[model samples]
Every structure is written in structure tokens, then in C-alpha cells.
Target chain A: MELFMPLFIAVVLVFGLIKKVPIFDAFTDGARDGIKTMLSIAPTLVGLIVAVDMLKASGATDMLCGFISPAAKQLGFPEELVPMILLRPVSGGGSTALLTNIYKTCGPDSFAGICASILAGSTETTFYAIAVYYGSVGIKKVRHTLLAALSADFTAAVMAVVCAKLLIKI
Target chain B: MMNLIFAAMIIIAVVCACVTGKGSELAQGVIDGAAESIQLLITMSGMMLLWSGIMEIARRGGFTAIIGRLLSPVLRRLFKKLPKDSKALCCISMNVSANLLGLGNAATPFGISAMKELKKLSPHSDKASDEMVLFVLINTASIQIMPTMVGTLRQIYGSREPFAILPGVWISSVCALAVGLTIAKLFCKNGGS
Candidate 1:
């Protein structure tokens, strides 16, 4: 894994040389574009990060989790995973912290821990991806992106529990 | 839609804070969150620049086109509106390859570049095209061959087999991707614009 990026870079540069491409000029131009992309995405990142932090600090996520616990349980989802599932789409850091907490409390090989691991491993941080990808291009109307992404996340969450039960022994 | 979601988050946070008497924590969170964003940007800039530079060379060397050609059969079904040889298809293939390898940092730059290419082909400058929505949907599903980070974390937490959840991860991810694509296709059919 560590060698992949270095190897990829070496191959690209070697290929560029063989093709007689001005590699240095291309690199600088692309880096300059990267800086502009960063600038364009900054504000959206700030707004999203702050909103997520506020939600965490305000205990609203916990409160929301509590409200959804029964429904989550009814769906055969672990009640303990309610908060992780809720935060997974919105905040990567938040869900990760929750995953560690689950590992601590439930043990890594426990049903809840296995489910949390699968949940974390399988799903992407939807809101962050949506914000960065669309925000960079200044696209205001995302149309069905959020709905589609969240639907996928929801499926991942449910399937995580289902697969954990069906696959893991303990 | 973005406006509503963002506004709702802030409003909910403030309301919850007022009721919970966590104003001080909320205030602190704002400062920390702002600082974290800058910190994240600084960390990402290096990877973004490096990958962007490498990808530029790859593009110039026609490597990205070769990759596009290799992945065209699979990508064509997902992005029917895009032409076979579209630049966006090349970038999207690169991004997908990076994501599958669990190279999250490298994937971001490629995905952003793909988004830009899609933007160029979009009739509406300010709205997402169907292809753009599908691209984002595929990314957010994040199909990976291995859950390396989760495995490492499990190892640190004392799991006997850190990669024991691999089957579960594969099953859930494939299911998620299938569901997300089906929903995206249905939505596009109902009202793409």
C-alpha cells in the first residue's frame, strides 16, 4: 500500500518522458489548478465542519439517536449503532470516534464491533464528498445526489448488521 | 437543497444548545471546527497537488486515455450519456481505480478533476447533470477491495484477526453500490433535470 503511490508516480513520469511531454510544466499547471480548487472548496468545508461540530457539541446527535433507537431496534439494527449510522454520512471523524468507542466497550470481535467495523469500512462520508465535489465546481443544485448517496449509506448500514450476523461466528 | 440542509443543521444545533444549556460547548465547537477545516485543507493540499501533478503527466502521456479504454465497457453502462472517449470518463476511471485500491487521498484529486470535466459537458452550469449525480453516488458508495484502515484499527484494539470483517465489508459495499445505482437510475428516469 505504501509503495503504490510512489510506484504510480514513477510510472507516470517515465511514461511522460517517453511521450516527450513537458512533465515539469504539466506538474506546475496541475498544482496551480489544485490550489484554485482548494480555494473554491474552502468555504463549503468550513460551513460543513462547523455545522457538524455544533451538532456534536449540542448533544443533538445523541438526542436524535435516542429518538431513533426504537425504530433502529425494530429494523433488527443494533441500538448501540444508531449514533454511528446517523453520523456516518455527515462526519467521518465523528463516526470514527464512535467506532473506537464501540471497539472499547464491545470488543473488536463482538457482534456490535464487527457490525461497526463493516459499517465504517464500507460507507463513504457522503455529505463531505457531496460538499467538496459539487462545491468545487460551484454547482448549487445537487438534484438527486444526496438522496441517492444517503440511500446507499442506509443500505450499507443495514447490510453491515445482516452480514455481520451471517458471516461472523462470535 | 444545500441551503436548506446547511440552514437546518445550524438551526438545530442552536436550538438544541439553548435547550441543553451547552452554549459554551457550542461556541467552542465553532472555533474548533473552523480551525479543523483549515488544518484539513493544509493536510489535503500536499496530496491534492501531488496527485494532480501525477495525473496531469498521466493525461499527457495518454495513460489516462488507455485506462479509460480499458474501463470503458463498465463505465459506459453507468454513464450512458457521456461519449466513449470523453475526458471525464478517463478521469472517472482513474478516480474509481484509486478508490478501489483504498487510496483515499489520491482519489479525491481524481474525483475532483472528473467533476470538473463533467462540469464542462453540463448544459446547466449551476446544476448537477445526471452523470455528475451518478459519479458522486458511486463515490459515496466507495467500493473497496480491502478495508485496510478498519483492519488496522481493529488490530490496534486487539483483534485476533483484523481483517476478519472482510467478507462483511465486501457484502455490504456491493449491496450498497447496487442499491445506490438502482435508485439513481430510477430518479434520473423520473426527472433528470
Candidate 2:
């Protein structure tokens, strides 16, 4: 499947060019715009990373871990997952830092660490995704979409824990 | 200074954890893991740029419009509150298509574009409407066919079978898409009425 990605891209480009089309110009324009978009997101990404480090520095991460430890145990998740979940509303990198903390503690091959991996991949950062996407377009009505996204996140988290306990064991 | 402080704390954690044999593996794992995560981000970013370029090309080439036309009927059924002719629909379709193909980093811009269109049609100034909410829900629950993030993790972990997750992914995503849309529709209808 991975092997097909390059092939697929080649096909798209080839198809575009063969159609008597302007491939080079279109691609350059897209790249130019992509750089603009990347610039917009870069600062936010840095700030998010820095703030996450600060939270860890302030011992906030430990407090979060302490609080979520019981739930983690009860839910059969790694205690480090608390910070992971808490950071979901804020930043992906923030949660990644927490997840690293988990894999470090639980051992990367453990169910706990794997579960954190699942959670990271499975759930969308609902509020953050909405805020960034909507803010880009100046949209306001879709605030209600958070409910649905969060619902899915809630389901995914529960399923992730349950599946980790069941499937990872298998 | 803060990054320096965090680094020190992590190093301390690694030593303490390793010495105590208390989750030291994870702390040490973090030390070993940093370069990989950074590398993964760089790789993912490249993919992102490539995808964004592809999307831009599609839009410029009118391929996106073609896709929108092909998907209009199906999208209309899924998104009833949103008008077929609206810019929101175009954005929504691009966003959904990007996610479905496991191109989320590329999807962000389209999603933003969609919302801009949706906001115009929306009567409210501060709040999202029913259609916007539904769009967000569907995008969030986006039945990802490729699960790029997971694939990346598997690759980083040296999984010889990274694509094996496809079955589980298809299963979970289909379930989430169906149920999420159903519940959102039900909730909106119930709530709005």
C-alpha cells in the first residue's frame, strides 16, 4: 500500500500533464500558496510547543498524571495518558510530548503505550481543529459541530481502551 | 531558557526513572524518541506540502469542481441543510476528500475555505448553524481510508506490516461515519425543532 503512494502521485501528475494541461505552472502556484499556509501555521505550532514545554516545566504535567492515574488504571490506560488526553483540546505536539512520556514509562511495546498510540491516531483534536479551520474562513455557525466531533472522540477513547485491553492482549 | 529547563527535567526524569526502574524505559524512550518524532514531523510536513500542492492544482485545473459535481448528489444526501451551490459545499467536499485519502494536513485549508463559505450563508454572527455543525462532525469523523498518522507511526516503529491496520481502520471508520452522521442528524433535528 505504501508503495502505491508514489505511483499514485505520478499518475495524478501524468494525467494532469497529458491532458494538454499546464502542469508546471499549476504545481508552482500550489506550492507558493502552500508555503503561505505553512507560514501561518508555523508560529502557532511553535507557540503550542513552547506552552506545552512550559506546562511540563511547571509540574502541571505531573499533577495531571497524578489525577488521571487512577482513571488510567481503572480504564487500563497508562497513567501518562492523562496529559495526552488533556492536551488534545490544546495542541497535537503537546499531546505528543505526553505520549512520549507514556511510552517512556510503560515501555513502548506495552499495552499502555500502544493504547496511547491508538488514542493519538484515533481521535481528532476537536476544538482545536474547529478553531483553526473556522478561524481561517471566519466561520461561526459550525460551533455546534464540536458536539458531534467530541462524541466521536469519546467513543474512540473508550473503544481504544477496551480494544487495547482485548486485542493487544490477543 | 524554557526549552533548556524542559530538557533538564526530561534528562533528570530519565535518570531517576532508570535508576528506580520506575518507568525509566519510557523516560529513556523519550530520549531515544526525540529524533524520530522530529524526523517524522519533517516527513509528514513534506507529504503535507505535496498534498497541498496537489489540491491546489486540482482546484486550478477544475478537477476539484469535477469532483464536487460527481459528489454533489451524494453530498446533498449527507448534507441537507447546506445548499448545493454554496462555497461551503466545495470546501466541505475538499475537506472530506482530503481526509478520506489520509491527507489531513492538506485538508485544513479546504476545511477553512468551506467554513468561510458556510459563514456567508449563515444568519448568525457568533454561533454556528446546524449545517456547519454537521460538516464539522463529518469532517472530524472523516472515514479515513489511509490513516496517515498511524501509518507514519508504524513506519517509524519499523513495522513491516504498516498497512495491516487497514481492516481495523475501515471497520472503525465506517462505523463512526454511519453512527456519527446519524446521531448528528437526529440531534440537530431534535434540538432545532
The candidate scoring highest on DockQ is 1
lDDT of 1 by residue, A29-83 (tens): 7777667766776777777777877887898877876888889878878776887
Worst lDDT window (10 residues) for model 1 chain B? Answer: B62-71
Candidate 2: which stretches are off by over 4 Å? A1-70, A100-110, A133-143, A162-170, B1-71, B83-87, B102-109, B173-180, B189-193
* Model-by-model DockQ, in order: 0.46, 0.26
List lDDT for all candidates, in order.
0.80, 0.61
lDDT of 1 at A124: 89
Q: What residue runs in model 1 are displaced by over 4 Å at the alpha carbon?
A: A1-69, B1-70, B189-193
Per-residue lDDT of model 1, residues B111-156, tens digit only: 9999999999988999998899899988888687656557656766
Model 1 lDDT at residue B2: 57
**Native contacts retained by model 1, as a fraction?**
0.80
